[model samples]
Target: MRPDLTEPLKLLAVRVERVLEQVLPTPELEPSRLHAAMRYSVLGGGKRLRPLLCYAGAAAVGGRTEQADRAAAALEVIHAYSLIHDDLPAMDDDDLRRGKPTCHIAFDEATAILAGDALQALAFELIANDPGHSTERSRLAAIRTLALACGSQGMAGGQAFDLGAVGRQLTEFELKRMHAHKTGALIRAAVLMGAELTGQADSHQLAQLARFGSLVGLAFQIRDDILDIEGDTEIIGKRQGADIARNKPTFPSIMGLDAAKAAAEDTRQQALSALSSFGPEAELLRDLAHYAVDRPS
Candidate 1:
């Protein structure tokens, strides 16, 4: 049985929020509108799952939360920037996010675009200047991990595949590869970044964490596909069946709902198994694996 994560997750959320609030520029700053938009995009919204995964990875290796904060903050900023860009008219064209108006919808399109660009820059700056990093090598490694994850070969590449796949039926292999890059890359980076911050994870340990990240990443997208089919538009904060409307290739669209659900379950099991080498300190990570599949939004 899964351990209860309610209190622990809430605590982590609060902790992460504090770190974000400190790092993000305030609305009073020059270029106030843009700064405000950036703050609005990052604060007081969404599940912060990526940061949570970062924290959980650190915990699994018996690392302190403080050590994970800069990485978590940087990754979350990148995630926020991606969401802003993904919601643009040229991309997913989403109007709503987390049940609120998307950045482009709430603010002007140009400002929204600029805000995303700034946030992306800030993410790298934070990683580069992180005082918590014990060495220049570690800091550079983290920066490289994030850059590769968000670059054309990773998230951006996946988004390109998704755009090309609309209205076209893709094989399961192709679909998985697309999401692995699009949705899974950053998630995988989050886990790896957390483990790396500990400076305690050995090669074998990092390998295990990588496997866990990959499994959870796939499972996360599979669950999102399921929700697009069965979830309420209001609850999901987007149009129900949006992917279907776009004719995008998703797990359920390719394999049927039952099969997609089974796939998520199988992936979840694999994620859990990857943590077998970890001790009780890994309970948060295990709970997060379950949350990835079980969350309603």
Candidate 2:
């Protein structure tokens, strides 16, 4: 029987929500304010794209869905933590996220900072303690993949590069490099972690998946740039033209609007091509590549 991705995605999302709820510290627990802030930032917001990518990567290698759950949840926790810090006064300073007040706005600035820090720690804990891995080596590898992605060489470093490039012109190559670290690293990690969870995917398959993740990550960022220009705040869940207001260097800024759209399509095609060796198991990944670029938000 042909599996329908729509139903499975819905189920996957439900499962992810449940796991996240269970995995995060309860808001009513001691240090209740921090726990509440963490829950406020992480739960009930955004499309869980990273987790979905993790699941897709697992499926690509014929891995069990259950085995992917912890990694997927961990990736999302990291993402949520990043958003909290990104919205702080010292950073992007945005007041809106996923159509609601940003974490610092909803909670006190101190709590928001603490929440972000705690979530980052929790992400590592989740992956390290994930019981689905068959051996300690596999778990360690997964931890290494995530840790490297979150550190200076990955998301944090990319963020530094992006901050430096603001109000400045950058070559297309430079912009891609910035996003590859800032936005793409965690996404790439999600894919690799999924494959690693299987403990069955060979080096060749992992390499191909990494390429696919990188292209899709670029496409996703380009689409975001486009949406910043074309989408309304009501629909996109964030202020439109915020990037232009901030003078952030983006794909459309470097390539022009028409060229940026073309670039997204080109990137998506490259991502799909990388998955050619896989069969039906990779359909979710292919669909996500399309959605990442085409989505209004």
TM-score of each: 0.96, 0.96
Across residues 98-187, which tens digit of lDDT does each residue of candidate 2 receive? Answer: 999999999889999999999999998998887755467877888999999999999999989988898898999999999999989999
Q: What lDDT does each candidate get?
A: 0.89, 0.89
Pairs with backbone N, CA or C atoms under 3 Å apart (clashes), candidate 1: none
**In terms of TM-score, how similar is model 2 to the real structure?**
0.96
TM-score: model 1 vs. ground truth = 0.96
lDDT of 1 by residue, 65-118 (tens): 888888899989999999999899989999989888999999989999999999
Model 2: per-residue Cα lDDT at residue 98: 91
Candidate 2 lDDT for residue 154: 97
